[model samples]
Target chain A: MTHLPYIAAAYALAVLVPAAYGLAAMRRLRLARTRLAALDPRPARRETRRETRR
Target chain B: MTAETSAAPGGFEMAPRAAMFRSVDALSSLATPAPPKAPGRSLHRFANPGRFLRLAGALQPWLTAGGLILTAAGLVWGLVVAPADWQQGDAVRIMYVHVPAAWLASAGYLGLAVCSVLSLVWRHPLADLAAAEIGPVGAAFTGICLATGSLWGKPMWGAWWVWDARLTSVLVLFFLYLGHIALIRAFDDPTRGYRAGAILALVGVVNLPIIKFSVDWWNTLHQPATISLTGAPSMYLGMLWPLALTALGYTLVFAALVTARTRAAVMERRIRALLMAAAAREDGAVQVAA
Candidate 1:
């Protein structure tokens, strides 16, 4: 634990940045899906069927 | 009917006119833009966004879950279970994060290069999106690598920053990532942006080998490779285990991130196309009314 702060900072960054980026991606996907569904529900329905079958 | 109104295919009389317009917009948008006729049939198979989206959707959850589990396990083992380095003491644990980030920085760029090839040579639709998505993620990993390396260097090397070959080359790599990210979004037309960025990515590939061999090529303060494909790792099994775990975790997570982002990019494009088609229909209706 001699360099605890450095260790902490590195780990925090390694985890947090990617996590944040992933969340943003997921959010964008969700928004896009919602818009796509509004425009036409067929693709979303197809996706749901595929998921259900899986 | 005007050209734009005619473009909206007939059907869906049961639905409202607005709904009919929306459906036509969506259908038109969903149609994949054909790539220039290319020789590689196998590569072209993945050019279809619908197929790629399906595959990505299936893989994303598994990748995310596995990555989180492995990364968490590796961090815990590195921090608590593994013995402290006798030379560097507790400071060596920084390698758990730093080394993986460093590896990802290089590996991610290699992926970008592949995307560049796919984009430039085959005109692969998915490749352009993948390249655009990969840049920012690659840049993030490189940034983490540099920050962690600096933290490690401050304590061990007595300098927070050094002009050593390995360090300098990696800094160059980081800047290359930044440059690619900026260049890809610099144009008014995205296709032009992708083309320019693809060229840059292809050019930047020269730095990868320099980065790989920098410590050996020059008398640098930075250490040489701890692990290589040709030889056994130069570390204890305890340390190696965590390193391996974290490295795989990082790789999986990187793939998942890129996949997710690309899917989002595809969706955004669809949304744009749909909006544009709808606008065209509206314009046509207005013209007809006038």
Candidate 2:
């Protein structure tokens, strides 16, 4: 059917957008973790303060 | 006075000076060593970023797994097993993707509005961060909904575009999501930005119900909701099952995404606070040397 391609494209875009967003979020998390590690040499100790506050 | 000169007078003469310095020292110590402000009790257990992070971290994997599995099952079944419409033919398959996205677009905004309320009223630490993270994801879904809806519309309506109420309000919803994301990051002070974004999100909530009831309220070309709270579902079981599966999958995926983003935002803020604290400490050291 003429609309078959449209259906396929619709689903493709639907999956692609959320996948891209999730991956981008993951990348940002990795970058933030790296920065956090660099800023605090003893990351464990710094996080300990957070743990205690909780 | 030089120590030797000061000692030339009776040591008792320095008592008032000593007492004044002691009081000043006490005041400075009290001021400089104030404890971190405690988090609010509104979401009591989850109000703290650290606690929220721990919870989200633990839930992420399960949510991801559930999302992936359900999405896979629904798409496979819907695309392969489900029969095509006799009238619309395979073009009806687009509903599998479009419906879930439309549902999420509206639901995600509902989430954003709730988070905004938690942030503004209860001052929950994670609320603003959650709201900030939710905006982009919600916007992405809304964009998907609009695009897919257009694709579905082109074949069904014979036009790729329309200014119908449902379509227009959903477009406005997409813009609201974009505006919220921009507003949250506009200021140098994140707190100010968050407050501004929170107010905007709360205001934007008025559009949601409009988006929900637009097809009914207006003489629009768009179709009425197939899924309803008051009545039985209009869709057949064959179509309903796949839609339900995909909707649940999409929700799980959205949850995973927002949770991950919120944790990242928490980490970013922690890093910023740490850097500020380190800089202040350095400044104090330099002052002591001077």
Where in model 1 is the C-alpha error above 4 Å?
Answer: A48-54, B1-40
Candidate achieving the largest TM-score: 1
Report the poorest 10 consecutive residues by lDDT, candidate 1 chain B: B11-20
Q: What is the per-residue lDDT of model 1 for residues B1-290, given as tens digits with 9 covering 90 to 100?
A: 12322233232111122321221122122224535453346567666667667767876787789778888888898989999999999999999999988988888887888778878987877788888988999999999999999999998999999999999999999999999999999999999999999999999999999998999999999999877545556788678777767876777778778878888888788778889999999999999999
- For every prediction, compared with the true complex, DockQ reads 0.66, 0.56
lDDT string for model 1 (A1-54, tens) is 798888888888998999998899888888888788788688767766775687
Residues B1-290 of candidate 2: C-alpha lDDT, one tens digit per residue: 23432233233222322322222122122123233463443244455555555556656677778888888788776777777887778888888878878877877887788778777987776778888988998899899899999998898899888999999999999999999999999999989998999999999999988998999998899998776655556666687667666766777777778777887888899898999999999999999999
Reference-based lDDT, each prediction: 0.79, 0.75
- How many clashes does each candidate structure show, in the order listed? 0, 0
Best by lDDT: 1
What is the fraction of true interface contacts found in candidate 1? 0.72
